[model samples]
Target: MGQAIVVTSGKGGVGKTTTSANLGTALALLGHKVCMVDTDIGLRNLDVVMGLENRIVYDLVDVIEGRCRLEQALIKDKRFESLYLLPAAQTKDKDDVKPEQVKEIIGRIKQLFDFAIIDCPAGIEQGFRNAISGADRAIVVTTPEKSAVRDADRVIGKLHSEQIEEPKLVVNRIRPNMLKTGDMLSIDDICSVLQIDVIGIIPDDDYVIKASNNGEPIVINPQSKAALAYRNIARRILGDPVPLMSLEEKPGFVERIKKFFKLG
Candidate 1:
């Protein structure tokens, strides 16, 4: 059976949905069948990020409430045949879907793909519990900011309490300039605080905003730095020992030539 993984952030605006979208697309690009489930219910954005929003006919609520079959709610991506999206209900509240129903649907869908990535809603509440109900593993997404890291720490504690231990961390929107200037938390600092394995480090790329605006995942563009990081994370998720991307700014051609000649 396919493993269900939940991408969540205890605090909102930490790129959880973007992580979910890119990771799912990256996995599919790497040749795995992927089903991305948006469990945010009333605040779903995975479909929009994946550029599949206009194609959603039936949603997760429809499948669980018997309004539609599970297959009927799965929207396939033309770019990647292996990639599919199970959009969240636009009209339903978080409390409307029970944890059991979420688990049941995830369990049933696991048989259909290599990986089922669940995009969890922000905050720790009924929606959070429901999103992680059937997940085999969890990916806690956060930024380098103190608030996001603090929230991520609490989320790690909550996940362990819920019997889902060892959730990996993905530090998003890391700025090299900030790190160099001592204005942002370094990976070392964040890891010391959260004490979890760092699975991914996404740089703050302007392309991400452009991609979001155009309803496309950054991962689809291999040239994007954030895309490379997401792809590496997907490879790591598949048990590949992919090294994290270097966050240091690339040397200019002049600097490279100077270094080549052993000059300062």
Candidate 2:
């Protein structure tokens, strides 16, 4: 049986989608049968990130409603034989999905794949509930900013209430120099507050944006530090003991400003 993981963040713009895309790709690279599902409903972008948008004729809605079979909706990636994507319907709203429906879909997918990665929408609403409904575990992605961390804390609390055990953490968009200069939160700080094991720590690397714009996830590219972080994360998910990346000096104000607008 496969493990279903929901990658979520309480706040938007915290790299939940990017993490899902790269992690799914990374796991496939490691030889696992992985199917990533975009549960964002109306705001479907995981297909775009995975560069499989043009290939998506059917989506999760199509399978849930019996308009298409599960295999028909799955878009296989060329880079990895085991990698596949189940995109969300761009026309449907979050309310169009229910927790029970998500559970059923995940149950079916688990029968064939080794991992089911759910790209959860931001916030603690119905969409969030739908995303985590059938998840055997979860990875909460958050940035180093105060608001993002606060929202992550809220998410952790909600997960506890739902009885989801030991949800792992993925601290994304970290700027090491900013942490040294007291401009951003450190990994230790975020972990201390969240009180969970850190599964991954990805730096705020500019290469991620370039890779996204090219419609290629960084995990497939060997030159990206962020990609290396994600690769290590995939290994960790498979119970490998890999060393964590260290945060170092960050770029200056001009470079930092330039990095903010880059899409990743």
Candidate 3:
């Protein structure tokens, strides 16, 4: 059976949703059968990020409420051979669905896909609980800021309380200049604070925002550093020995970042 992994952040605007989108896309690009679920309910944006919003007819609530079958809610992305999306209900609140119901849907999805990625909501309330219910593992996304790191720590503790032994960390939006100037938290700083294994370190790149706004994930383009970082994270998820990226914003960064990731 395949595994379900939840991409969560206790705080909002830390890139959990973005990370979820990229990871799923990267995995699919790597030839994995991937299913991404948006569990944010009323604030669903995974569809928009995946650029499949226009194709969504059935949603999570529709499947959970028996208004439609799970297959009906699963939107296949023809862009990838086996990438599918199960979007959250736009009109329903987080409380409309229970944890057990979410778990049931994900359990069935996991059997069909190589990986089931859960795009969790922003808070540690009913939505968050429901999101984690179906996950076999967790990827906690955070930023290089004091408030984001602090909230990530809380999330790690909460994950342990829920018996998720070790949730991996993805440090998003890393500004290399700020790190070099001691203005931002380093990877060591964040890892020491949270005590979790670092799975990804995404650079703060303008192209990533542009890709999201344009309804295409950056990973599809191998030219951007952020895309390379995300693809590295995906390789790691596949148990590949790709090295952690060195974010050096310089004159020849494109070539240097490729060498760091050992990509052709």
Candidate 4:
């Protein structure tokens, strides 16, 4: 049976949607049948991030309400054959979805895809619970700021309460330079507080915004560092032993030279 994974963050604007979109695309590229569900309800953006906003005719709300078949609600990606998207209804409210309905839908999709990745809404409310109810695994996305870290801790607690064990952490928008200068929290710092295994570390790359604007996920670009991070996270999810990427804390050509040598 395929696993249902929920990509979530307690705080808003922590790159949860971006990570979900890219991870789904990366998993599809890795030859896995992947279905990404946007469970943000009314504030849907995964459709736009995956570049399928205009193609969405039927959405999650429609499927649960029996307005359309699951296949009809699913939008296939243009670039990856194994990739699909189940967008949320922007016209509906969060209360439109019940936790049981979301679980049933994900359970149905699990049989058809290798991975069902749910892009959870921010906060620990009804939308969040609905998104994570069916997930076998959970990935918490957070930044280095104090508020984000605090929210991550709360999320970990909630996951445990929900019987979701060891939900992995993904520290997004990390600036190595800031970390080195003591201006930001390092990966170690974040992990130390969260007390969970670090599954991915994504840098703050300008390419991410550029790719989002163009309606293409950075993971498809291949040349982007953030894309590489997302791909590594996918491999990790699949039980591959890819080494983690180094976040540049100190600004200089010395570390760059060392990184180059290591790559070579």
TM-score, cand. 3:
0.94
Residue 45 local lDDT, model 1: 93
Residue 238 error, candidate 1, Å: 0.4
- Candidate 1 or 2, higher TM-score? 1
Residue-level lDDT tens digits of model 2 in 23-91: 999999888999999999999989888888899899998888999999999999968899999999999
What is the C-alpha lDDT profile of model 1 across 132-243, one tens digit per residue? 9999999999999999999999889989998998999999999999999999999999999899999999999999999998889999887799999999999999999988
For the record, the alpha-carbon RMSD of candidate 1 to the native fold, in angstroms, is 1.1
- Each candidate's number of clashing pairs is 0, 1, 0, 2
lDDT of each: 0.94, 0.91, 0.93, 0.94
Top candidate on TM-score is 1
TM-score of each: 0.98, 0.93, 0.94, 0.94
Q: After best superposition, candidate 3 residue 152: deviation in angstroms? A: 0.5
Query: Which portions of model 4 miss their true places by more than 4 Å?
Result: 249-264
lDDT value, candidate 1, whole model: 0.94
Residue 230 of model 1 has an lDDT of: 95
Candidate 2 vs candidate 4, lDDT winner: 4
Over the stretch 166-226, how does candidate 3's per-residue lDDT look in tens digits? 9999999999999999999999999888999999899998988899998898888878999
- Residue pairs in collision within model 2: 177-250
